[model samples]
Target: MEEQSVVLVVDDVKTNVLIMRQCLKEMFQVWTADSGEECLRVAKQKPDIILLDVLMPGMDGYQVCRQLKADPETAEIPIIFVTAKDSDDDEQKGLEIGAVDYITKPIRPAIVRARVSTHIQLKQHSDKLKFMALHDQLTGLYNRHFLAERAAQSLSAMVRHQQELSIVMLDLDHFKKINDFNGHHIGDLVLQAVAKLLQDCFRKEDVVARMGGEEFVILMECGLDIAREKTEDVRQQLARLNPMGLEVTGSFGVVTANPQNAELSHLLVLADEAVYKAKADGRNCVVCYQDGAYLTVEHD
Candidate 1:
């Protein structure tokens, strides 16, 4: 099951904390702090949202907010200032200090609930939009732009860690033919189905993307043997999906990153060539780029 959203309620007054907790307990996992110092300590646990009271005895909400914003770990968490100071200056200060919203006290329970719910929903929606922007809409996999960006970053990490990195480019076999016969809608369904299969086969950390049309790419921080195994797994999965009537299969090409091949574009080209070889040898197979060449996997 998914984890419940967590909220941190910070107020010097016990009564105010209790009231806020009562209002939020139904929808969220709640934590409270009686002082700004304690609020900082509790924030280390990383609550999804924070309800902060501005009129605390020591280290008020503004100071607490500034401290939270200063810390890289807690910087992204949304903060809402709940205070009796409802003046224009108070609101301006709260906004300027990076608080997302402000609610004046003697808080209305209904308003509190509504505002919290709205912000949480907006956060969730914003996350979805970010995912969509970086991923293919039809396949629900990373798109070309995301793939390139991720590949470059992965390459940089590989260099820093002195680790091996491999890129596998997979192109669906005769994908345009499927669209020609089955209509574009069925083609889209087939792409989504294939994407789900890929996600299941690869680790969550591995970068997987649909690089336009019937092509997809996988970037892995693994040796050649493991890359081969993973490539075969994806190929077999696609082949198994042929019974779905779209007749889907994939040809894969792999290229490992080396000192001689530092350029991402160069590795992609090598992988593309290997993919071409897989098609030449007979589609629906995997090929590895080795010593600036591609070798096909021959089966008995």
Candidate 2:
């Protein structure tokens, strides 16, 4: 069963809070905050939707909504204004401030539930579309787009901190043979299995991504030595996998860019050159690129 969506109800009035809780409790996991200050704190939890009252003691709902919308983390959250301040100007102001819907007080339970349900559904759909845009449909790995997005950010931080960063690029050996021999469906399963192994072998901080068919990249905050060692280990593990009883191996290229030239695009190019060298030397081997020289670290 799917998890229940969370709804945060923010209001200063105890009775109104109780009423909203009663109306929503059965349909959602309802969380309540009695003041705008507490609502801001609770908003960090990222509830699916927020029901905010426009008037409160210290900070008003408008201030809360403005703050939430200002923050990138919480900005996408849907906010619905539920209050007694019922007027054309009040509703217009609330809508202008980013509330998805405005409901006047002396509230009808049924109408509030229906509106909340509709907006929550819309929020879910929007969230899914965003996820699909950033992820690969196959293998469920980060696609080239996400990899490029994170690469620039991480590269910037690496240069700023004077820290080490390395790129490990992998390409399956003779991948077309797998699709030709085992069929695309079995080949897909092999790719997924390898992706899972990559995920398990790398740390949470590492960015592992699929850069189109049969090619993958790993970004890690380590020197060439550590990157090559880790890539070698994954290479051995992948060789042993034999996913679906089909033997498979991948060629790996490891490279650490110079601090003065810490650019992802340039680093990737060197990594690709190293991978090509690995394929030339022999398949299922690890190669490191340093000072424009490719060194074979491991071979099988």
**TM-score to true structure, per model:** 0.83, 0.92
lDDT assessment of candidate 2:
0.91
Weakest lDDT window of 10 consecutive positions for candidate 1: 291-300
| Candidate 2 global TM-score | 0.92
lDDT of 1: 0.88
Name the lDDT value of residue 186 in candidate 1. Answer: 85
Worst 10 residues of 2 by lDDT: 257-266
Query: Which residue pairs come into collision in candidate 2?
Result: none
Cα lDDT tens digits, model 1, 1-300, are 777888899998889989999998988899989999999999999888899999888798999999999999998788999999999999999999999899999989999988888887777788788888898888789998898888888888788887889998989999898889888888888888888888899999889899888888888888788898888877887787763565788899988898678678998889999999999989999999887567887643
Candidate 2 per-residue C-alpha lDDT over 176-240 given as tens digits, one digit per residue, 9 for 90 to 100: 99999889999999999999999999999999999989999998989988898899999999999
- The residue-level lDDT of candidate 2 at 169 comes to 97
**Global lDDT scores for all candidate models:** 0.88, 0.91
